[model samples]
Target: MPAPERIPPGRVSSVDLLAKGELTVRGRVREASNAVLYCSVSYEGEQAHCVYKPVAGERPLWDFPDGTLAQREVAAYELSEATGWGLVPPTVLRDGPYGQGMVQLWIEADPSESLLALVEDEEPGEGWKAVGFAEVGEGRTALLVHADDVRLRRLAVLDAVINNGDRKGGHLLPTADGNLYAIDHGVTFNVDDKLRTLLWGWAGEPLPADASRTLTELAATLTEGAPLATRLAELLTSAEVEALRGRVGVLLGAGVHPLPSGEWPAIPWPPV
Candidate 1:
């Protein structure tokens, strides 16, 4: 593993640290599909852990253009910020050990947080929402469910807007401070309908007041010359940006959570 470079003592923000600091690869997240590097960044004596996904390491997907996943991940962060939801950790696009990539602040998940679970009963019970049934092993199946959490609900809305292709349970991070952050958004923002996720609990339900309001504000922010629209233009194609705006408009018009279109698999493989 490479070591972080030494720097003088000074204070800088997390985003600045990730962007300007010396990035040293501490290890690899072996379970990740892409080259997810666990790295330490230091600038002016400020340090933080982050996940770096170099564009070169991204595997070519038939649906998405080559070398665009990193930018898509950054785009997801931008949309999350625009929603004022703070659902995504601080993220930036910058050069790293391998090359330019998406660098995002790492968040430690609280082990005790019970956000998702498998239940034997048909119903998800109070305070929980059913995703569907899943095969556990040995021909037995269990009900997969997630918390009817306000935070997770907001994330579902964000996922819908981003056309997130993958929103597995493992991507959710619940910190000790009770903050929930979602990660691994590289498979997002496709021009096609790819909003696969485990957050279908609220599907077809009426949109929450806060979510409706956020979508309304987001629609205005996505206007041609708006700041959010301008930033997205840099990361995504014009058609993709237009699709995003269209999704938001559809959500606003529906006034309810969207149901899966059934054109493709509604949930990701390996739900966790």
Candidate 2:
């Protein structure tokens, strides 16, 4: 494996280190469950909330080298940046005496929110509204419907192409200004059969026009050897790309949808 990317420690400044608390208990906005520490940090001189994943003495569900996962995460963020997804960005992947971890831009938690909150909130001027469907009592519920259904459908197609196996409610972050963000991609782009997630409840539905356009754009960019594709090729194999393409085709095909029959391990209980 390649050496983990190095980010300067203390680069964020002391004022940003707000508090170290139990994220789950405190109800902080967390992108992953592996490790959590809440803090305030300055990103580009702007006061930003941040989370630190301590590398030391923590356990991950997978057995990948701590260093490699951090590097892959950094790479994933870089890809997101290149795609102009605004979902995630390149973060500080770091290593210390404790082991290896990452420092990511923190998203504020919605105070009066639940997964259903997105649907109720109105779109703000020039802001992205984070909206998705939630599984409610064996049926699908629209969580946030601020954006046009077309845009949401396109994002769903993108998720399929990425084979994102963990598109849970917590992964969706909506800025008060209206921008929706997706995080926690460590489990994606792997050369394995782990493409499971909760967002595929509407599998057989026709691809919304916006989604078809986005997929066409992504496919064209990949065929033309976009830098993002070059990077993905490094992490994923030809077969993986083919599978992604196949998934896209399936989503676009007539009367095709994801059929949920058995319980999946990756899906959290009482999927939010």
Which candidate leads the pack in lDDT?
1
lDDT of 1 by residue, 1-272 (tens): 33333333566877788899899898999999899999998888678788899999999999999999999999999999999999999899999989999999888888899899999999989999999999989999999999999999999999999999999999999988899999999889888899999999999999999999999999999999999999999999999999998999999999999899999799998778
lDDT by residue for model 2 (1-272), tens: 11222224655442233222112112233444566665444344334445556655335656343434454455556545544554663365554323456556566544453332434333422333333444445564545433333324444555555655566666666656656666666655554445565554355556656556555565555652777667666655566555655665655564243443354454543444
**Each candidate: RMSD:** 2.8, 9.1
Each candidate's lDDT (Cα)?
0.92, 0.50
Per-candidate TM-score against the hidden true structure: 0.95, 0.60
Cα distance off (Å), candidate 2, residue 257: 5.9
How far is 146's C-alpha from truth in model 1 (Å)? Answer: 0.5
Highest TM-score against the true fold, candidate: 1
Return the TM-score for candidate 1, rounded to 2 decimals: 0.95
Task: Report the CA-based lDDT of candidate 2 relative to the real structure.
Answer: 0.50
